[model samples]
Target: MTPLAISANGPRESYGDKLVLDGLGLEVAEGTVFALLGPNGAGKTTAVQILSTLIRADAGEMRVAGHDLAREPDSARHAIGVTGQFSAVDGLLSGRENLHLMADLRHLGRAEGRRRTTELLEQFDLADAAEKMASTCSGGMRRRLDLAMTLVGDPRVIFLDEPTTGLDPRSHRTMWEIIRRLVADHGVTIFLTTQYLEEADQLADRIAVLDHGRLVAEGTAEELKRLIPGGHVRLGFADADTFEVAVRALSRTLDDMPRDDDALTLQVPSDGRVRSLRALLDLLDAESIEAGEPSVLTPDLDNVFLALTGQPRTAVDPPADHPVDPLTEKAVAR
Candidate 1:
């Protein structure tokens, strides 16, 4: 078995009256991105806090980088980094200074800290803005700096709680690229929680959905999507007669099929399995139905999220007062 980078065995947490996390369990492998998703009131943040040693779990075992979180909290903390939903960069300090501060907190000596700071500044492409105040940098630049600061300790696992919350589409993609490089090149395992369904679709090797403190679903994006019955194969016909014929012919094979009279299209529910699609095609051929071609519409992550969480996936917009590039704003408008 591949050594796990992080694991939580039935971890639970609760407040006086409200239960936050209820027997949550997870296992993430090295160099893979694992995403946890939930609605606003779900315990996504609480999970990250517990896993990273910021908060203690009410019960169960937690491990990071081979260290038991309960027995070796300090060792576990040293091997993991955390980037919260909000930026931790100080406005008054320059980008380089911010990196230096993180290095100092990690107990790196002055000479080694400067070397690590310089290396990270160039790696994140922040060398040009290294001397400028972090607050003056663009949203993307600030995010890169914030992430760079997280690496000061050279952690094997990083917990990112909505790391790209306020970023524009372009910067959102940039963050994705950075995350990929971290896994592919640096062998870092990522534990991410994000509001963007697409982000999880594009990045995570595995995804788990939490609803009301319980894990409702866990799988790859396509696997979760397959669990929903929203997929259908639309058979388009040339005329009303053909449409009716196809519908009648398909009705014997599938139930609750939806059809459009005006458009001459018949939709057959599918499980997105190849055998099902091939069976439908074989049936059409046997009946000589001549349903020109079929257009398959499978459930996307949006549909999967809604089905599992009982809510639509919503983008976390930047604060209203924040400045957005005209192009970024247009992308958001879409």
Candidate 2:
């Protein structure tokens, strides 16, 4: 049987009279990454909160890790881990102490806690900095410690909310690799929310775009990019004379050709495929028009997010008491 890590239907939430999530529905499969992408205040965090049992949805049928979110929140909580955008490591604690603290909270015995702590410190490359205070650690080190702490319970599912927002490029890539390893090696399901389009592209097996509290689009990265209309091939020439000749010859042969004189380039609409490129090359060859090297311009996640969600991805500022940590009392009041 395929294990479902999270399932929800018609989830609704409101703050005062403002409805945040309207009929929001989702289902995440085991051992895969499900990325949630959205603009600020689009209820991405709210969705995570509800699924993790940190908050209650006004109305919904929900289950997480085989536990009913509304009726058995404690059971649901025991089955999942969360690492949010901000560093959850206490500045006063050493990296080793932080992991040990989580092990204690999970009720692991002295011997077991020590073993897990040592293993995670090595796994997260914190063995060298095991005794370094979190305040003295680099951004990457803190983030890794935060993740290591989350793994103490060995939850089958994890929710990572913008987990790499402030890390350096190399650090961000390292986190990506760690996330992949967790899913592949441990068979853990990951539910990720992030403003970084590149992060979603690199990690998510499937992506859902939320706009105005509703799921506006959902698909694989390539499938989502295909929705936009501007993907095409452009041909440039050294001089205007060849460009004009190519345009006159290829005008009827292509769909959309926006002629540019100063740059001596003719834009031709394309589906961004090898066959289409070959056809364009053959047409140019047949016409005997000297054309510059052909290039394919396909829409990326930035273009797709804008076209589909009508908004740009922006970092969500962490609330004063960020809820990423296990010890934090961030559960929403019922």
Candidate 3:
């Protein structure tokens, strides 16, 4: 088993009268992506701030990259890197210059800084835009450069807050690929917070859903999907007669069997388990009913999110034009 790169317990934070986090705990294994998901104002950013040592938690015990976040903040800072929702690139500087500045901040010596900067530019596919001013770079290029800057210190753990927000599909996929390579090639542990369910589904080794400053659910994508109701088996029939007969037979044994006359299909609520499927098949065999084909439709993350959060997937977005406060941004800088 991989060692844990991040271990936190009983984290609590409040912003004046509003409570942001309520004793939430988390664990992330090394060399894996741990995605934290939440709707708008669910304390996702607050958690990131606490973990990255950007803000001190009112109460919590946290160890990031094996350094105590509260006791040895400097050590923790040295071991981690953070990229917030906003771009950290210097718009006035060229891409190469921005990277060099980060390297200088980390005191990576002039010779080593140049070598590392060259390597990262090539790795992130920014060679062509190396000399281009950051303000003129495309959204994707800027994101890549932002991440490249985060890597300048060679930190073992990285926090990416809404890394792919507002990106087009192609750019989003490009960022996903880069994130995967970061873990696979460099063994970096990533803590990601994103509203995009598909991004979490594709990149996270495990996911946790936060609501109102608490962890409502946590598991791998498949495990989380299983928590939601609505999985079922769809049985297709060869003809109308067979469909009606099967429906009649199934109606006696099943509750709320949904039938589609036009399509000659019956939808039976199921857990999509093999044992249940075998039992269903056996029951149909006893009734002498023939179903042309059967397909299992399992619940997805969207369904899980809705069932657990009591809101549609679309509601997960933060309020329009909601800006990150300066305090939050300063915490990200640390």
Candidate 4:
């Protein structure tokens, strides 16, 4: 088995009056994307804070990038980069300057800093806007710059908390491609926390759902989807007459198959297995009901999220004027 890049067991944390993380534990393999999925106030950020050494957990043991997070926080810090929900770019500085600032903080010498800065500007496609003030860059450009700055230190692991939260579709896709490249090309381990179910389904090698400060589910996307119950087979018809015929003929075996009159489609509940599909097809063939096409519809990450968390897969925006948790703000700002 591949070695773990991140491992934490029995992590606990609390706010002044309420417990936030209740003995949450997880493991992430090296060079893979591990997504922490949760609704708002589910302690996703809190877990990030603890693992990144931003906050001291009430009790837990963790190793990040081969360094004990508690005993060697500085070593762990050196191996990790963080991009939080908010942009960390310095608005007054140019993209190139932002990278240079990070290199300097990492103690890279003048020539090396300049070389790394130029390299990152080109890699992130920020060379065109390298000299432009970050304040003038588009949201997508700024995000790229932020990530480029994080790479200046050559971190082995990166924590991205809602990195595409406010981006447009195009920008979101751009970020996803970059994230994939980070793992594929650079062998970086990514710890992503997001409320976007599709993002987790698309990017994560493994996913864990956090609810009420505890992990309710963890698995590959397909495995988690299997935990939910609503998979089905959808059959499209060339005309309404065929759809009605199939519905009536299958009614004896399956009850209440949903039909879309306008689309001429019928949905039958099934496990989406080959045997089930074969049986469905045989019955349809026997009845002489010709479907235009048949598609096996399995449960998606949205269904898994809802089934595990008992919450809809909706974005829960933070409250206006919400006080920023100081520990997270401090860690992510660095």
Candidate 5:
């Protein structure tokens, strides 16, 4: 079985009397993406820092890349790479030069350094722009180069803190594909912290939501989404005649059906499962009531976030001026 790349239990951090991460727990298995999601001041950054060996946790047992963090920080550091929210590429250096610098820092020999640099450039699709200065690169290109540099050490695990922040939709999707390939091609586990719920829903194998420095929920994206109610199946009919027949057929199949004649759609509560759907189709078939189309609508991460946090997701903008806990700020600053 693949081993765990990162794990933590009841991690705690504080600055004087103010607690930042209180009993925070997380885990990431090898070659899987575990996304940490939360509003600002939720201690997401502190968790990343502790797991990545940039800072120590006050109270908790944790391991990274199979190395006990408190007992062997250096070993953990060697096993993982980090790409913070901010770009690390120096604007003055060309993309190739930036990668070469990372190779040197990793202590690769000159010949190996150049070879690694060349490989990373091609891997990240930066070869065409390798000679361009970092300042001349677009936001997406710069982020890609930063990630390429992080892989120079061939770390088995990587920590990405809001890797796609402030990018266009196309750029964001580009990063998502790269992230997916990292785990698929290299078997590298990724510990991600991001405010983008859709990104977590799209890429993470499992997700943990943090609030007020504590984990409020954790599960697969679909599992978390299922916690919120209001999911249903929508059956569309070509005409009102067909809709009426469907309504009668569905009424016998399930309870509490809401139908709209104007739209010619019937909304029925469902978990969107194949068995339930099979039953619905059978009912329609028996009644000879045809549905033009059938689709399932399930709750999304945003709904789950709102329900769990008891606050709107929009309220926790990352740029808000609210004071962050000192411990969290200090920890992420590293």
Candidate 6:
């Protein structure tokens, strides 16, 4: 069994009278991406802060990197790295200096710090700008440098809050590849919160949706899509006779199966799962009906987010009590 890198049960928090998190609980396995998604003010940032040891929860049991949050927060911090929505690069320092500063904070010796800084500079393609002031780096370069700083500590788990907010198309995809490699090559578990629903679909192994300080839904992307309506497999028929037969066969199994007489097609509610498609084929085989290849249509993550949250993913929430964690932005900066 894989050990859990992060876990929380009945974790609750409030800012004065505004309840930020009401018993929000979650578990994240080692070497996997777990994305926490929500509209603004959904306590997503609060959850990140609590789990990453930047803030205290009002009540509950929480552990990160196998260390209890209450008793061993420093130990947990040693194994965790955070890159918030804002860049953490110190504008005064060069990219290389920024990384070396982070390594020094991790207590690495000068030689090891230099070696790691050099490796990350090349890995993140920042070697070209290694000697340039961080303030002069492009948006993508700054984003890359920010993440490189996070890795200087060799953290087992990372919390990323909207890591790609200002990236362009090519840079966005490049960052996605880097994220994938981190899990596959380094076994680093990621806890990500992003505005892009497609980012979750592309990168997350599991997703948890938060609304009003509570979990609304949790599952794989496809599983969550199944929870919404308007998913079906459209089976086209050779003739009216076969269309009627297919609809009659599917209607018996699926409630309110739709059909188009003029188009000679029947729509059976099903997701993109292979087993579901195979079962539909078995049913057609039982009836000896010759239905052409079926086309499946299911709601995407955008639709799923809207259906579950009662608002679009980009919609802003009511005024939240979120304050930027300066330490999280620059965990090792002096």
Tens digit per residue, CA lDDT, model 2, 142-203:
89999999998899999998899889999999999999999999999999999999999999
Stretches > 4 Å off in candidate 2? 1-3, 236-249, 253-255, 260-265, 273-293, 311-334
Top candidate when judged by lDDT against the true structure = 3
Candidate 4, 233-329: lDDT as tens digits: 8989887778778778888877668888998888899877788899999998988888866899999888788778885333222322235556553
| Candidate number with greatest TM-score | 6
Provide the lDDT at 291 for model 5: 83
User: For residues 1-334, could you state the per-residue lDDT of candidate 6 as single tens digits?
Assistant: 9999999999987765677789998899999999988888787877887888777777999988889988998999999999988888899999999998999889999999999999999888897679999999888889999999999998999999889988998888988998999999999999999878999999999999998789999999889999888888888999987887777777776788777899998878887789989998998999999988889999998888888888533422222234534654211212
User: Tens-digit lDDT track for model 5 on 1-334?
Assistant: 7677888999898755667788987777789999998887677776777778776788899998889988998888898899988888999999999988999899999999999999998899997669989999999999999999999999999999999999999999999999999999989999999999999999999999998778999999988977878889898889888888777767775788888889999888877668877877888898888786688999989888888876523322232222444654333211
lDDT of 6 at 25: 81
Q: TM-scores across all candidates?
A: 0.87, 0.84, 0.89, 0.85, 0.88, 0.90
Candidates in order have lDDT scores of 0.86, 0.85, 0.87, 0.86, 0.84, 0.86
lDDT of 3 by residue, 1-334 (tens): 8899999899888766567789999899999999998888788888888898877888889999898987898999999999889898999999999999999999999999999999999999998679989999999999999999999999999999999998889999999999999999999999999989989999999999998888999999988987878888999989888888888888887888888899988889988888888988998899898886689888988888777777523332233224445555322211
What's the best-to-worst order under TM-score?
Answer: 6, 3, 5, 1, 4, 2
Local lDDT at 165 for model 2: 85
Return the lDDT, model 4, position 54.
73
User: Which residue pairs show backbone clashes in model 4?
Assistant: none
Mind sharing the TM-score for model 2?
0.84
Which residue ranges in model 4 land beyond 4 Å of their true spot? 236-266, 273-275, 282-291, 311-334
Name the TM-score of candidate 1.
0.87
